[model samples]
Target: MTPLLDLPSNREEAWRWADLGGIAAAAALAPVAAPEAEFLDLPGAKLLFVDGVLDATRSDLGPVTLGAVDPGEHPLGRRASQGWTLRLATDAVAEPVQVVHVATGAENHLAAAIALADDAAAQVIETYVGAGWSNRLARITLGKAARLMRSVRLLQAAGFTSLREEATLGEGASLVTTVLGAGDAGTRIDGAICLAGEGGYAEFGGALLTRDAQRQECAVRVRHAAPNGQSHQLWRAVAADRSVASLAAAVEVARDAQKTDGEQSLRGLLLQRTATVNLKPELEIFADDVKCAHGATVGELDARALFYMQSRGIPKARAQALLTRAFVADAMERIGDETVRAAFVADADAWLERALQSPSRSREGLGEGSR
Candidate 1:
């Protein structure tokens, strides 16, 4: 049988390290009714979508306008057949807007388009919950001098999930993104941000935690299309048990993008012998005057530090959790909003607690047991 969508495979460089074949097979099954899940308690203008369908009764709409958006020619548009659209029409929105995508069934599609008017400023949060096969897409466009902060959280129980995001920044605009991903089964996310106008700036930070047999990947491409553009990307991942995590970040500077400044850094921590972590950082600069830097590193926890803490009367599990939490806290701190940052930090702490319950005992190398 022909699949509804032509999913990419290892042949494609973008998906070379991900297990897209398994995800595609799982997505072929019919969707079952989704189970009930608790929603995040946040005070703001919020919108909720259940199984790709909007739930108007539970939503609080204010100055922001909500409508239906056609995915059009987007690569994953077809998959988001029933996603929602959001627009920031006002010059400045004091209260943040939150969007929640909940799935209680299989084969669900989610998509959204966000547009910011000129000189506008807004904060947006996206929360994904429940378990199922999902293909999600988000498109963002920023007008001149606009400022936007986007935060995405994926706390799915267990299922196959894929998300793709594209953003374009106008002159002097600023865009910041913070992501917290925890998927039980498998998850993959790809994003691209283009500095289409001069003096545009972009900053992206992400933290992910995977346990058991979860397979996760995050890939991003940042393009400097105009002169004096700037971009920075930082990603950290923690993989335990037999899980796998991969991070790929690329920055491209065009010939006309002189004086461009771009930097990318990816760091991963392996928690077990059976776990795997892959980090690939690439930089292509066509302009000689541009400044760019990219680097990736993967290693196990510092055993000496862990031993020092343990010798200081800390339990083994507690010591491990403390060290692991510090590893990923830098990304969480990058979130600008005080409330949002607190929420994400709390979630990370909870994940660390759960991981410490079944701490990794393998100490094959990487200075483990050297003390």
Candidate 2:
């Protein structure tokens, strides 16, 4: 068993904004059996995991193999006793696959690996739910000219949930990822994208919503190791009722990575004075010929915009919801599948409605000076 001290803390630069105490508490508790809960109503082939172990009775794995794979060097990943491995045949095109993880134990760990052969293409959707401390690790490898699209949803966890994914792209490979986080717990997502081959491309879009003292954080690092590689990161976060949302994004360019194009945009919205949003964007470029840029902004809802909408006969709560929805649309648009995108957007909308309806002392001065 891993020691409690092995877990990351605020002293670490990468975990400076994380909930270390919550993580420690969850890790110290004893593991329990999976609880009873209804699975999400998602379409296509699916794999269900209960308490970090695959539940074959409730899963339809389709073509994805069920076995162990390499769990990287992460401290939590090393403790994973079970995992799944997925591989695509060369030049093959496959349908979408869904992977759902439910954590009801005091401590749960899972690992996953996805590899695409040359010229192969595929899409995957991952969902996380249930309570307790759930830690996950995933490693992805794309062969030459391979393409992969992935979407992740972190929803309705009542305890600490952490996920870390590392992806490496080969020559001419392409990867697109979209993430949505709206959990009622402390959630953390760490992503590392490495463009290891020339002409590789990677794009990431994420939307996060936190309310009622919940916390959500996403940290991503994109490394351009070869020439002509391009990567982009765009993220939006919304916090309400003393909740906190944060994003830490970084881009790195190797000395030999000429003509590398890297861009990052991080934006946050605070629904109340007590709510907090943190954004950090960093660029480390060793190549003088590369083009890398990053931007971050954190602010409250536009008072002028709300006043205008109110003057036009829209109620204050309704107007706020509409504005927040629009703010999250950019990240939703990154999803290529219309059906998946719509479902994620609907989840965000529902969360917003619930947050606005709940009475909270933090929202006391909502429109005080906004005449």
Top candidate (TM-score)? 2
Q: What lDDT score is found at residue 84 in candidate 1? A: 57
lDDT of each: 0.78, 0.83
| Candidate 2, residue 75: how far the Cα is off, in Å | 2.0
Tens-place lDDT per residue, model 2, 1-371, is 34644777677889889876666665665555555544345555788888777788988887787777677677666776468877898998877888888877577888888899999998888887777888888889999999999998887457878888899999999999998997786888888999999999999868999988888888889999999999999999988888889899999999999999999999988877678899899999999998888888887778888889989999888888898899889988878887788778888988888878866632585533321
Task: List model 1 lDDT by residue over 245-308, tens digit each.
Answer: 8999999999999999999989998877678888899998999998898878888778889889
TM-score of 2: 0.93
| TM-score (all chains, Cα) for each model | 0.92, 0.93
Off by over 4 Å in 2: 1-5, 28-44, 361-363, 367-371
